[model samples]
Target: MRKSPLWIASFLLLLLVQTSGLWAQSAKKASYRNNNEVRTVQGCEYEVLKGLAEITEVEKTRSKSESALGYDEYSVKFKFTPMEKGQQLMADFGENSFDFFLRSGYDRLPVGPKYLKHYYVHKGQKFAMEFLQTDDKTCREQYTYKSMGIPNDLFEAQDSIKAYKIQIAAEKLYKKEKEVNEAKGIAMAEDAATQASGNRPPETAPEEQPKEEEGPKEEEPLDEEDPKEEEPEVDLNLPSEEELRKKVEAELREKEGLKKSPDEMDLDALRAQIEKEERAKAKAEAAKQAELDQKNAIKREKQAAKERKKLEEQRRKEIKAKEEELRDELAEKLAAEKAALEARKAAIREQVTNEIRRESCVYDEKISGTIKVISVEEGPTEVESLFGYKEYVVTLKFKPDNYADLPRKERKLWDKTFTFKLDPKGKSANPGATYVRIHKLFKGNKYNGFAQRLSSGVCNDIMVYSPDLPIDASQVRK
Candidate 1:
């Protein structure tokens, strides 16, 4: 039995189709997963099937940054059976060739998540819904793709689907039109009422009836009905507006009060009793105001006390800081004084040691010098000039008033203005080469000296003598 390839291929395809049908029939129930366990991707809806199986409505989602590749669509379900008894849902269409006609519905879905996030079951197929994003401006493009959880090639004939959908829509619209026409007929009665009130026929008034002629007839009496009967004085018991309002208000208040005891009722006594409601209301308001004021006063007093305490604490801190600073300053001053005193004592000790050594170490020479007082002046320039005026002076040391401190007596001598003439040999002899030292004394007993060769004869009051040592005149020449 040689079979053509086409025939063999067709047989295998038919077998596959029959096997799928069998599988579908066997697994004819909707399946779904637990909602809490699965996380649906954003902008995505699940298609649940077999009562518990997970299904995705669509994998494609539109993004603001990028346009969709083709067209994203939402699916409408179709069933071979009724929704409930004879009622049929719009989404349900006849399924003849497939378990579900995914492609037979509208090309694009609706625009709300609320409507799309649900599961629906049709004849042989379970459906999960999704809505496509739509705008009045965007044109919809038709597309076909694989459905989640369903292994079958689904094709949607665009024109056929559109035509059937139009037919279904026309049916819906015709029904709506019939309802509208019925409503219009009912609404015309309002126009008739308006015409009667205006004493004129409406613009859309119905055609009038023809008048009927009659033979000679007996005259009916005018006002045959009794006037008294027409104007019967029936008791309506309808209260006036003011009285009704008061009665209603009182009833409402009574109900609200829930006063059930008969002993609580006393109409005559209640009427006699003066109403203190306004007074009570006023008293309540006053009491509230008083309570509020008392609270505010307490709060203000507490705040004031806190502020006072803070200020006092701050003042105490400031005073304590100031005292500490003063103490520190006094301690620093005392320390400085002690340092100065120690320094002065060391200088004195050094001076006394040098003096003792000078006296002990006697050389085999004796020398004497004198200076005659000439003139005096009192400043740095005058002191400087003294250095230049001396002649043939061996050596002389002069301290200026503002220079350094000297031995107490020398300091006093330098403070006063004076002049001196010097004799290097004796008190009245001619000096050899002359040299002079000028010094400035400072407030801190600090001295600075400047020495130079004297020009000639200016040390009039100066005297110089060496008892334990002698200087070689030639060697000492300036």
Candidate 2:
């Protein structure tokens, strides 16, 4: 058959598009297969941790490493006995168990020494772990483990466990791809060596015999059909990406404390207003109390001043009364002294008058004579008296005026001297009237007085009654 050029060109273009589409579909299928392999490994790890395990020991060690720069690297290791029920499941797994560890989102866990000590405290307790599955079936689950009655803080770490699991899976995938490439390179090198040594019989014979015996294997048909039969079913009930984003946004709002109703916000504002009013009321009450205290202090000061004035007035009155009492006592003492002095002077005068009258009666005769001489004598005898009075002896010589007509005893006194004792302080005689008066009789003056004679010829009482006659002043000798 003859074909048109336009039809042939259309057929070629269609074949190119279908071939490109098939290549894209094959690449996508391979990517999904790799992701499924990683998820299956992670799910098996989660299943193992879900069972309870008794923690036998926990140890922490520190070591210096070049990777840690200048700081020490800290690591924690745990030993646990898996429960009997989980042992059968662990044995059934063909793959090796994962070495589980906590890591931070921002950096490696146990960045400081305190976190190392935190794991050391939970040594011999049984713990149950759970891996909370996410909405995305392909993503690793979150890790949460705790012992009975233990706080969640003991198991807390930074970042999310899912992120660490994802990183572990990526490292494993890289290692697996590297191993596969290395194996393919080794096979290619072996084939090239066989072709180059075609002339060497012994090396070529051993290799060619194995290839011949293993040719056209019966398992080839089963290998081709397995992928189609074992493909995983997709779940249509899972949430979409947009729904996940909304859910995450809602949780963030709740955590940041922004999810509040209008009524709740108003209630918070009312509470703040009430608190402010109460504080202002308390301040006003405090000010009022302070003012009342100031007024009370002023009143107390005035009362104290009144009390002090009263005390001062009472003190002055007491002082005045004491002075008056002292003055009255002094006046009474002076008056008593004056009355006693006057009484003593009157007694002395009466005593002198009585002594003179007694002497005058004893000497009945009077004599008139011219005094020739007069003398006074003081001796020890004058001072021998109770009143300490002084006595004097008065000696007189006189001429009798009527010598022939006088009696014989009186006639003898004319040309004779007479002596008399006199008390000048009135202890025995009237000194004022007799002794003192006799001292006025001058020499050679005429005197008329009574004289009494004693038995010893001494005159006892001699009175010069008056001067004989008023002589010329120039004629009298004082």
Cα lDDT of model 2 by residue, 110-224, tens digit? 3224444554445455555432212223223322233433233414433334554444444555565567669989999999999997776554544444454556756554445
Query: Which runs in model 2 stand beyond 4 Å of their true positions?
Result: 1-53, 57-100, 103-113, 122-177, 200-478
Q: Best-fitting candidate, measured by lDDT?
A: 2
Each candidate's lDDT (Cα)? 0.41, 0.47
Cα RMSD of all models vs. native, in order, equals 26.4, 40.2
For model 1, give the RMSD to the true fold: 26.4
User: Could you tell me the TM-score of candidate 1?
Assistant: 0.22
Please provide TM-scores, in order, for all candidate models, with all chains considered together.
0.22, 0.22
